[model samples]
Target: MQKCGLTEKSPGQYVDTIATDAYVWYEENWQHDEYDHSHQRYQLTYVEEGYQYFHIEKKIYLVPQNHVIWIPTGKEHRTTSEAKTVNLMLVLFKSVSELEFYQNVHVFSAPAVLKEMLRYASKWNKVLTEDTEQQIFLQAIQNSLPHFCKESSGLQIPVPTDSRLIPICSYINANYQYHFDSDVLADKAKMSIRSLQRIFKQETGITLQKYMQLIRILKSIELIDTQQFTLSEIAFKVGYQSLPAFTSSYYAIMKTKPKLKR
Candidate 1:
């Protein structure tokens, strides 16, 4: 292993100077609400245990355990982990060969191989010298990232920024577990239902109904992660009156059935 050269520089300064290829770290019992910031390096954050909510631009992604969030270089974002105990493996690459996958932010399912590679890479948590084994190994991980990242988890919610739509969105987010008609949202926004639907689609790129469904599904993922509720209970908790309705909507978003974390 290459010896770590610890420096007194700030986090940004250290990453900018020391990371020639990749900088890696494994954080246990990690919980933080980070400020909005951008990085020069492409970042991969793997959630080994708890979950994190990543706000990238207008979208909020729920990155649950056994999953990874990839943020391209210079993407403005912030992350909040409300879970009391979390394990995260974070890797920042100066650059990678896969430009397509590195162009946008995505959440992908982390396979066992990738997780094991991350565990091995965690040991080399500092700046790596060129031509060293550590650098080569880290490079391999960077190369494999794009391949494994193709399977997206589809756990994101797009938010609207329009002032007229803000309250409606807040209402839906807060009451995602209850069924409400579009009229309620229209009343909240002080707009006609037709106008509300149009502006919501224009700003969020999805219909108001779809957005509400997305919120419900997002909340369901959180509830599922807790391992405290049965699927039926979670379905009802997230506003679905029946299990089949919940399963159908969940499949539409996640492309898979909800897995109980037993």
Candidate 2:
């Protein structure tokens, strides 16, 4: 996604609010590009299946299955997914208050109930009001969203202000899910414990342990949200030996539990 002034440019026309929903988009456009925007009535998304990649405010991200990209109000952001991806996206303008809480960007897992609503909302163009079936699905979607938008605090690691942590930061951003620890990371940065620790937090707004925890939670969210991984599998995958500790930390950050679908 490239950054620009606010305005979404799409070749196809979308459903207007009176017709069914404010908008319901389900299609594949490989070379897709959306113009920038300051704010909108509502923005929500669902990843049916596929590998989702996005670069919001210059930071690259992976949005996998059961993923929801909720762009609050109008924060200029752009995104695209590759082939082999099936997604359901909806924009509701009539009810949501006009407020954008995120100044930068955030990536969050779509809760289970919202995932089900995406499945339902994808059924028709404006089935939301038609009472075709699951008429309450819209309410479910709205209710499931947080009353006050969360600050852009999803899985994000700070870039070292010191400039020395660049290589290591890149590695961690690229390999957060892989098995590695501070010693290995320190080696990658060509620094020892005390030096790396001092610079890492000063630049990143977090300690090494906290930073690793962020990586662990991020990897876990991707697995739990997109790939079909049991929490136990995710814990091990993120280098957590004790499942209970990982669970506690995950909840502290996401405020949600991990429950993968069968």
**lDDT (Cα, tens digit) per residue for candidate 1, span 67-129:** 998889888777886665688888877778856877878798888899898888877765355
- TM-score (C-alpha, index-matched) for candidate 2: 0.57
* Best model per lDDT: 1
Pull out the clashing pairs in model 2: 6-36, 6-37, 7-36, 38-74, 39-73, 39-74, 65-226
lDDT of model number 1 = 0.79
Name the regions of candidate 2 deviating beyond 4 angstroms: 1-21, 27-42, 46-54, 58-67, 72-86, 92-152, 157-163, 173-187, 190-195, 224-231
Question: Candidate 2's residue-wise lDDT over 1-262, tens digit each?
Answer: 2211123344322223244434445543233454333444456655565535555553445555655566554445455554344444554443453334332244566756666666666665443355635435665565566642343364454545465787887777677666676788888888897889888777766787777677677667656655556788888888777788778888876666666656
After superposition on all C-alphas, the RMSD of every candidate to the true structure, in Å, is: 3.6, 6.6
Number of colliding residue pairs in each model: 0, 7
Using TM-score, give the best candidate's number: 1
